[model samples]
Target: MDPAKLSNAIENVHRAGMPGLFAEVRDGDEVWRGAAGVADLSTGRPVTADMRHRVGSITKTFTAAAVLHLVDGGEIGLDAPVGRYLPELVPGERGDAITVRMLINHTSGLGEYLPYAYPSLRAFPDLAECRPQSLDDHRLTRFDSTELIEMGVTAPAAGAPGGTPGLYSNTNYLLLGQLLERVTGVAAEKYITQNVIERAGLQDTEFPDGPQINGPHSRAYEAFFGMIDPPRDYSVFDMSYAGPSASLISTVADLNRFFGLLLAGEIVHPSSLARMQRTVPIVSQEGKVIEYGLGLYPMEAAGGGIFWGHGGTTWGAGALSMIRGDGGRRMSVAMNLQRWNTLDASGRPQPHPIDDALAALYRVAMSG
Candidate 1:
């Protein structure tokens, strides 16, 4: 891979509308890091390669690996029902049917609780109605995971348990968090921090205890599907609502090390890694079809090659970390902007330069 070409791709993202972005690529022992645009548009602070950023749903991969670590040690069962562990949270008929496997793969049929939690953004499948009140109101609110899970479980099931074309739901991951606490005798975040992050030797990765990120980082900006006239900075926000599902603060270098180790069986046992790659069809929040495994997904690259990783976004921060199937090449990127597209008259997202730039960036990052 050409570092100059990769660097040019990142610069294009900013020129094409991204507020800021930082990325790292690994081709064997050689490494390249690049950053573009201003991190804080107001202060004009530039982004850097080593800065910590909220990596959103990539946290799910950590949670899933920690759970599967228990499986490797015979502390948990892959197919065991969550109700067996947290009956009070899951309970009754519904709990009995959905297995741990289903939760990891988002096939448990639980509906997403986001719409209920953020009533202002409840008009799902319709980005045109997006608003920022709930996000603003609860910026520092520490949410109880159980309360959040109940909002999802009690609402309705998107499909039957083990059904094909599963719906992606954060509720399932919240339940897994509860299960982690029950089995580990510690909070899910703590267990994952110890077992996964520490084990991966990722010094720059951690689950935040509160709203503030402890080190240097970019100011995250959210557009709310272009409802917010000017994208608002949400750099400091409580992540309890996302819990073990989405709240991870990390850097690009650490992400590369972690995902690389994960694919090489240095973290979970090879057998468990196999299960993590066993995919099922999932209908994402935006109604896009993605092949999801435990927490990782198999992404088909430009040349029909496969890369395993996850992409995630919070109010204003987003990231994607991916490693080639052979573990020979890797890419991890963190961005300061989220949902930058404006909605069209038909309530569909109008194409923006950011999308094309990002698509081009990934192609270059993954190419040889």
Candidate 2:
């Protein structure tokens, strides 16, 4: 496929409804970068391919790699019980049954803590609900990791530990962060920065210290499923609520570099990479099916072969990165606006132009 096709696809995305978007695609030695749309709708400032953006849950891969570093050092066991290391946090039979592997793979059968943290999101039976009003309520509130983890632990178990079709939960990643702190004698973010981010040679990625972005960055615009008219900017909001699970800020280029190096066995050993690529049937927060691995997932391009990567989203930002199995091709994309779809009577997102445009863009980006 021609790079122009991908460029046009990005333009189509903005025209379809996205506020702004930037993307990078790689084919062996050939690379292409493009941006289309505004960085700030208020000022009409354009977005660039190199600007830093919140990569959201893509932070999970970094966290997983950091944990694997300890695995490579023979300091942590993948199947070890969480209770053995963090009894104070996970405690009792439930903790003993949930292994580190379960935590990373999200088969620990733990519940989500989002609804508990942001009460407006609670749907009663589970924490798998979302409410835009809650986003405004907690914009500046800093949440502690332990507090979040307990919400998941105390909630009724989603299923037995290591069960099939595991549930996706931020609580799992927070536990991983606690595990990292236990073993490394430092904050999880510190260990990951020193090990995974630094080792990947990613310069723009970091666990932000505060609500403000450090350098050049597009403002994050979220619609909360179109509940907020004209969308709202959450660019300066604190991310501590999601810390290890979804707080890392990065650029598209850095994301491509990280995934590329990860697949090439530069950050952790090849065996560790193999473990990260192992996928299982899992249910996402949106109740969608995803082939989730330790912190990675597979996206099959149209006849382009299997690509392994991850997609992440914050309140008003979204990003996805993918690389071929052989590491010869890749694509990393970021967008400023999120959840542009409005909900109808069924509580499902009504069809919108942006959704189709984003799908088309990915198809072109990953085309062979």
Candidate 3:
């Protein structure tokens, strides 16, 4: 790898307005790690390669791996209706029609709970007197999965169960988390930690049970909808609201290790891993074309080829982990800022700084 090119990529991320960013790349026996910007803007603490960050939806990959592990063990059937495991949680009719496969592949058509749970203060009659911010006051409150599911269950369904195109809803994985517990008699966190984290030997990865990140971590900051005067310190918010959907915290090294091992067929059985790579085209709400597999995503590599992994976004953090399919090359990127959208007046997303940063990083990481 060219050091100059790699350094330029890291600098590009900083220039994109990310307070801090870190990344790890692995090709065969060679490993490259880099960090730029401040981990804590207040203290001017620079980000380091080993610093942990909230890897939002990337947690879905772990959750999906756990679910697939159950499938491999015959404890759970992929084609079986999720209602078979948690009948009381899902809507009576819709639950019966949705299969575990649909949930993992994001074809369940379930609504997201966050919007309902934290609607704009102006929209909620009872909270009209409260601040306009959605999650400001509830940041520290521990939420129950059941209540969160109920919020989705009551919201308008995105489409008929398994009949619509891929709709990325955290509700799908939230229910899967409940299903994992129902099947294995273990919490989703424990199952994933044992099956995925431990299996991959990710020493710095964990499913934190509280608001605080236990080890060395970047202070997460969020400009909620870009409305907050200054980005709020959301590094300490209770992750229960995100639960099995987006609660995993990890470092770039650990993330790279996990994805590397996962694609190498060490995390799940070959057959199960193959199934996880089967994907469906998904156009994100922002109109980006994504191909989502069971818990993984196929990103078009800069040098031509597919890199499989997932990207995650929490309120104050963002993460990306991808491994080339043809070779074992892997890269993981993390940022300490969230809601960093640059939208036009029509609310359409324009390319943000992270896009340029990621493109630069990918060019270097995937280069031979």
RMSD of 2: 1.6
Model 2: per-residue Cα lDDT over 258-279, one tens digit each: 9889999999899999999999
Candidate 1, residues 85-151, lDDT tens digits: the string is 9889888988899999999999999998888888887877577776779999999998889999999
Task: Give the range of the ten consecutive residues with the poorest summed lDDT in model 3.
Answer: 123-132
Error of 3 at 300 (Å): 0.4
* Global Cα lDDT for candidate 3: 0.82
Predicted candidate 1: what Cα RMSD to the true structure?
0.9
Q: Which one wins on TM-score? A: 1
Point out the higher-scoring one by lDDT: 1 or 3.
Answer: 1
Clashing residue pairs found in predicted model 3: none
Candidate that beats the other on lDDT, 2 or 3, i.e. the better one = 2
TM-score (C-alpha) between model 3 and the true structure? 0.94
lDDT of each: 0.92, 0.90, 0.82
* lDDT measured at residue 219 in model 3 versus the true structure, 0 to 100: 86
Off-target runs (Cα >4 Å) in candidate 1 are none
